[model samples]
Target: MDKFDKKILDILQHDCTLAVSEVAAQVGLSTTPCWRRIQAMEKNGIIRGRVALADPEKLNVGLTVFVMIKTNQHNPQWLNDFGQIADEFPEIIEFYRMSGEVDYLLRVVVSDMKAYDSFYKKLIDKANFADISSSFAMEEMKYTTALPVNYL
Candidate 1:
């Protein structure tokens, strides 16, 4: 990717709603080349899907919980089953298999303590776990979807 491509990516990362013409102007490129670069990026999978960022408070799910899980079962069948279980819940937005002390981690959002309690009960009933710990986020200090393009 060249300077023009990087500039286009940076601008789009900030506001994807901008029209192609507007982005072209900002990146100092004419309409055709700018649009072509964006198309190329999308085809190559550098540019993922565009989405509107929603307000969690307005949606009535402001509480964020980081769940750290440790499990004794390390077989592929157990991992696949756990993955399916995680997919069953809309509250689980992010899930990951880790390399450290924790076997897995999940980021969940819910309305309040009552909602979380219900979710926890269902989660425990679905599978067996060695340990599960949760930490509530008191405040979001910093959050952004934009990624740096300098490395490219």
Candidate 2:
């Protein structure tokens, strides 16, 4: 991508709600060219999607838990089943298969201890686990959805 494209991306990543004209103005481009660049980016999958950020505290899901999971069954069938199980729970916002001591990791958000207890029971019932440990996030020091565009 060129400098104009990088600039456009940087601006859009910060606030996508701006009109194409406004973005064009910030990037020193006319409406047509700026709009075309955005459309091209979307078509090429450079711009994946746009979304509104929500406040977890306002949503009553302030508790963030990092769950590290280990399982004896590491076969494909077990992983497929676990994926389905993970899909069933909305509390699991992010899930990943890891390469270290932990087999898998999940970032879960919930209301409180009572809610987490209910989720934990449901999870254990749905899957087989050799070990599962959790660490609660006391504070979110830094968080951002924006990605650096300097490499572009």
Candidate 3:
């Protein structure tokens, strides 16, 4: 991608709601070319998808829990089952397979300790885990959807 494209991406990353004209003005481009660049990025999967970042407190989901899951199973079938279990819970905003002591990790958002306990029960009921360690986040210093434009 060119410098203009990088500028366009950086501008869009901050505020996706900006009009093409607004973005074009910021990046020193005409509307059509700016629009074309965005479209090309979308088609190429550089721009994955746009979303509104919701406030956890506003949604009654004030607690952020990082669940470190250890599992003995390492087969495709087990992985598929784990994927299904993860997909079943909307509270699980992020799920990942990892290397090292933790086999998997999940970022779970919930209303309270009680809610998390209920979620834990459901999770254990659905699948098997060798160890499930949960750590509640005290504060979120930085949470952002924007990736660094410098990487491109």
Candidate 4:
């Protein structure tokens, strides 16, 4: 990946819906070369996949909470079971295995406090977590799905 590839990645990260020609124009490349570069990136797994970002507020999902979880067991079977349970729960937007006092962290989204309470109950019932703590986001000052590409 060179400068042009990096530029392509930056543009795509902002909006993957841009046409190859549009991307080419923005990145100062002709259509064929630009398309080829994108194809190469996709083939090499540098460009994984594109997705749409939805407005949680507009969708009636106004509450966001970060749940820190400490599991009783760290065995492979327990991890697999937890993973499966998390996958089945739609309210869990993101789940990560972290390095800290907590074993896992989950980004949960729900309609309201009541909905979050129900989700929390469901979570505790579904998994064998030794400890669980939640931190609610009163306001989101800044949120972006895009990663910084300047490092590239």
Give the runs in model 2 whose Cα sits over 4 Å from its true position.
none
Q: What is the lDDT of residue 68 in candidate 1?
A: 97
Candidate 3 residue pairs that clash:
none
Query: lDDT per prediction?
Result: 0.97, 0.97, 0.93, 0.92
lDDT at 107, model 3: 98
The per-residue C-alpha lDDT of model 4 at residue 71 equals 79
What are the candidates' C-alpha RMSDs?
0.8, 1.1, 0.8, 1.0
In model 4, the worst 10-residue window by lDDT is 143-152
lDDT by residue (1-152, candidate 1, tens digit) is 99999999999999999999999999999999999999999999999889999999999999999999999999999999999999999999999999999999999999999999999999999999999999999999998999999999
> Which prediction has more favorable TM-score, 2 or 3?
3
When 2 and 4 are scored with lDDT, the better candidate is 2
| C-alpha TM-scores of all predictions | 0.97, 0.95, 0.97, 0.96
- Model 1 alpha-carbon drift over 4 Å, by segment: none
**In candidate 4, how many clashes are counted?**
0
**Tens digit per residue, CA lDDT, model 2, 10-81:** 999999999999999999999999999999999999999999999999999999999999999989999999
The global Cα lDDT (0 to 1) of model 2 is 0.97
